[model samples]
Target: MSDQPPSHGTPYPYAYGPPSYAAPPPFRIPDAFGWSWDMLRVHLKVLLAAMIPTVVVGLVLYAMYFWRLVPIWIDMAEPTTSSTVQLDRFQDLWATVGLLYAAALVVAIPLSLFHGNLVRMCLLIADGGTPSYRMILSTRRAGRVMVTTAVLLVAGVLGTILCLLPGIAFAAFSMFTLPLLLDRDLGTFAAIRGSFALVRAHLGLCLLTFGLLIAVAYAGTMLCFVGIAASMPLGTLILVYAYRSLQVTGRTV
Candidate 1:
């Protein structure tokens, strides 16, 4: 048995070959950030191309969310004269809420699919390969991405309810789940476990990387969220760089 999957007579879209660049020096957060910045600079056009659709879709979803609230707004705008009218309004409100929940579920599917493709792109870039926006169209392994996201969400929420530290731990350990699944085609639980094991083996480094990534993202938020447009992708690239480094220097069972 081999870690590498059987070739399907294709160039193997994900990063799977030898190092394209020289071995990087010891893990440094600044170095990772600098490398990620350089990647963004070199690949800005393709990155923007892939990102534009996601932004457009997200804006559409946001509009749909507000549109769904129109009924509630109208119901509240008119003063009810009778108890029956009030009851009917309440029912409509609840029904509208239900519709919103359903819409969220529907939206999650495509968002998760887009997220997986983005992970694929990041991994490919980290491997020193130039990728196209067309790669974002791939829906392969989207189910794994959705399942892993759902599991992480549930586990993280439960951990948060128990204690804040537990939630942070779950998030930190599971950082590599997406990359593993998208790059290696690992199953949901397998990817989760592999991410956990890999992070645990290099706990200090992984934790520092995760913490700094969060801090950078938070800093972006403080700049009126316009910065998030830059921070979020940069953080992702930093993590992907770490993932690629770990994958090259170590092995996951």
Candidate 2:
């Protein structure tokens, strides 16, 4: 018999099963930082644009806080040690504190949105997608992001107050929550749980990665506090890259 069917309508071949796919490569912590650095170099403009607003907001808030308290501080510093004067200064200090608290409350929503967008931007870069400044300003799931942030803040504060280790663990495990929310469209609590699962699977690696990121951020702050403009984005990109790695390696929830 001929090896192939003679002038058959279909090509002669043995039955073939479904194609096989190669497993994704193992996730490497170093690759995350390396790839993030590459992204930073190539996408500097977009990253910097996304980062500038955050820095500006922080600076403006700090300036406002000090400006409001400067007069009270000066009054307290003056040598007019009268009981009435001291009482007035104390009242002024309390009023200033309340005003700052109100201002922070008002700013918290937008700040949370910005942070979520930063994660979104870094995730996009890590996924080999182009990101823009406009995209940074345009955020989705703003309400969920804000609520999730509030939950984390409260939990982290309570944990820290009770014991240091729980707070540290929370910070490490929850690092990917924002990325999960943006990438997987998960609800707030679901994203938090997913992040916990991911970190749990590779607890040591995740903790080491988180610690390195903190070091990078601290180094940036040490650069006359201006290096944060670059370090923050770089650290975020590294984190997003690691999150992507976990997804590909099937380590993510």
Candidate 3:
């Protein structure tokens, strides 16, 4: 009777808290790959434009290796007239190798600065936003991206020297570092940590994505090496799409 009488004032049992909503499930492998391909198809032009720097740098590096490194190796292999001459030639060979490496870094470091811009463009396209070539070319986070890349390269090389597994693990953990750095404006270490966390949380999915991308790139290579121009950008778009889906679902590392 008292409850009925109090009906106008409030419910018989007052609500204690806000209603809860269930979280969405993690992205399945098929869904992730499908979405990535769809996004790539939609933004094909912009994605291909983004790959220009990568392609150019790759060509330059290849040319340098073929022209400079090959001659050095050939000269080093040939017989020399005397011990002193051999020693001098060996020193010259080392000097040439060092110079070639330095030259590569000089060219590659600047070109790699564009990677952040490319990732940003991919993310923008994934979010249904149309980004212009001029806008995509603006690399505000180039310095940070370059530094992070150098760190990862050193870490990967050191890990590889120690054991191959650690190198693979480092690469897997860093799959999202560039995107995280660009999107979040995070410091290098923070972005790296975030990427590691994301990968650690979804290790199997990350591995699948990574392996599939490598396979795609390899296929591109097999097709007279011209396929890389298309495959590389497509792979990048796929990664951006996967990252977008994870972010949307609030699946942080």
Best by TM-score: 2
Question: How much lDDT does each candidate structure score?
Answer: 0.73, 0.78, 0.72
Model 3: how far is 11 from its true place, Å? Answer: 25
Candidate 2 scores a C-alpha RMSD against the true structure in Å of 9.7
lDDT of 3 by residue, 1-253 (tens): 0100001122244377754445554666666556666666766787777777767777776676668767767877888878997888778777877787767655656666776777787777666687678855786877888888788877876787687989988888898998888888999899999999888877787889889878878988776556777786667766776676566455675
For each candidate, what TM-score against the reference? Answer: 0.69, 0.76, 0.74
> For candidate 2, lDDT tens digit of each residue in 142-173?
88999888888777767776778888879898
Per-residue accuracy of model 1 over 33-69 as CA lDDT, tens digit each: 7888888777777766666555666556656766877
Which candidate achieves the best lDDT against the true structure?
Answer: 2
- Best of the two (1, 2) by TM-score: 2
